[model samples]
Target: MKVRATAKRVAFGLCVFCLLVYLVFPFGWALVSSFKTNAELFATPARFWPAHPTLEHYRHVLANDDFLRAALNSVFVACSVTLVSLAIGALSAFALGRYRFRGRSLVLYVVLSMTLFPQIAVLGALFQLVNALGLYNRLPALTLTYLVFTLPFTVWVLTGFLEAVPIEIEEAAIMDGASPLQLFAKIMLPLAAPGMVTTGLLSFIAAWNELLFALSFMQTPDKRTVTYAILSFSATTSSAFEVPWGQMMAASVLVTTPLVVLALIFQRRIIAGLTAGAVKG
Candidate 1:
């Protein structure tokens, strides 16, 4: 029996090692490749470590015209979408979690149904709507469009979190002459902080990384987000025949680094928020 258990442990360790390699390898390769020059990158049987490690790619990407603007655009749009989604979602979730209302399940079904709608299917109509609203090719338009994706999930997650908060605590607040607003502000909101953070982070990442809508809605180069900025390297110019892989990868790393840091920082809270209501009634 001991021998069998030891073998099982060995197998589990091997499986975990494989999974970590699978996840880490691509990112490691990207980091390595980002340091390679254009000439070195195409060299046969690419070197794992560049013989002459260079900061050229990072400098070039950062110095590129409109790169900083694009990064700021993405940050602004993402922050806006996350904040708006959290506010609206939290309010709706609180209402649904705390009170019974007519068509409650139906409302949830409708919200979930919106999530099922493919972005591609609505792109044409949404583009027209944005144009009609005179918000075409603007960050606000992208933020609004992102809502179609983030709001549903935020509402769903926050509803679960709010539901998990005990009614007894809320009841006690109510009996202590707490107004509805006071109870929610002083009690429920504090209790739901973890969920809010989790949902907001997810929303921010979604809005930040979204490429398709950013590509479609944004036309001006200076107004483009980081995802759209990648296309700048793909343009066919007299001097360049191929995309700048090193710079593109470097830019991608820059764009994604903050999200990685955020995830590392709050991974535990995110897990707790996701699981908070699962075990509760």
Candidate 2:
């Protein structure tokens, strides 16, 4: 019995280790491959590590004007979307979490259901609306469209956070002459920080990596986002199309760096947000 238990533990540990390697290996290879030259990449028998690693690919990506513009556009659109979604979602979450009114549950249900709708389902309508508003080929269009997905997610996650706050806290704030807006701004908002951080991080990542909307809405090269810019990195010379694997890998590594840093910085908050109100004592 003791031997069997030990064997099971060893097997479980090995499985977990393998899983970690499987998940991380691709990114690891990309990071290493980004430094290799085109010749090194195509060498016989293939090399796991570069013989002479160089920063040329990274430099090439940075020196490109269009890529830089796209990077800025991505940051602008993503940040704008996150801010707008958080503001709208926070107010809606507070009302739904704290108040009782006619059709409140139904409203919450509707908002939650919006998240379940596939992006492709509403793609056509969204394009029409953007064109009608004359926002096509603009960063604001991306910001506006991203709200369809981010806002609902933020509201759902934040409602859970707001509900976890003890009613007594709000009652005490009211007793101290705090109005509804003051209570939310001064009290509940601070308490819901973890949920807000988690939601904001997720929203930013989603917007940053979104390719379809960016592609469809912004046709101009200068207005495209990082995801779209990566696609354009495929080189076309003299009727021969060549994919710049090294440069693409470099861009991928750079693009992924910010998200990894954010996740690491907010790792604890993300866990707290996810587990909020899970086990009530």
Deviation of model 2 at 130, angstroms = 0.6
Best by TM-score: 2
Model 1 residue runs over 4 Å out of place are: 236-238
lDDT by residue for model 2 over 1-281, one digit each (tens)?
99999999999999999999999999999999999999988888889999899999999999888888999999999999999999999999999989989998899899999999988999999999999999999889999999999999999999988988998999999999999999999999999999999899999999999999998999888899999999888842223566788889999999999999999999999999878767664
Task: Looking at model 1, report the run of 10 residues with the lowest lDDT sum.
Answer: 231-240
After the best TM-score superposition of candidate 2, give how far the Cα of residue 90 lies from its true spot, in angstroms.
0.6
User: How much is 93 displaced in model 1, in angstroms?
Assistant: 0.5
Under the 3 Å rule for N, CA and C atoms, how many clashes does model 1 have?
A: 0
What TM-score, to 2 decimals, does candidate 1 have? 0.95
Estimated TM-score for each candidate: 0.95, 0.96
Top model number, lDDT:
2
Off by over 4 Å in 2: 235-239
Model 2 backbone overlap count: 0
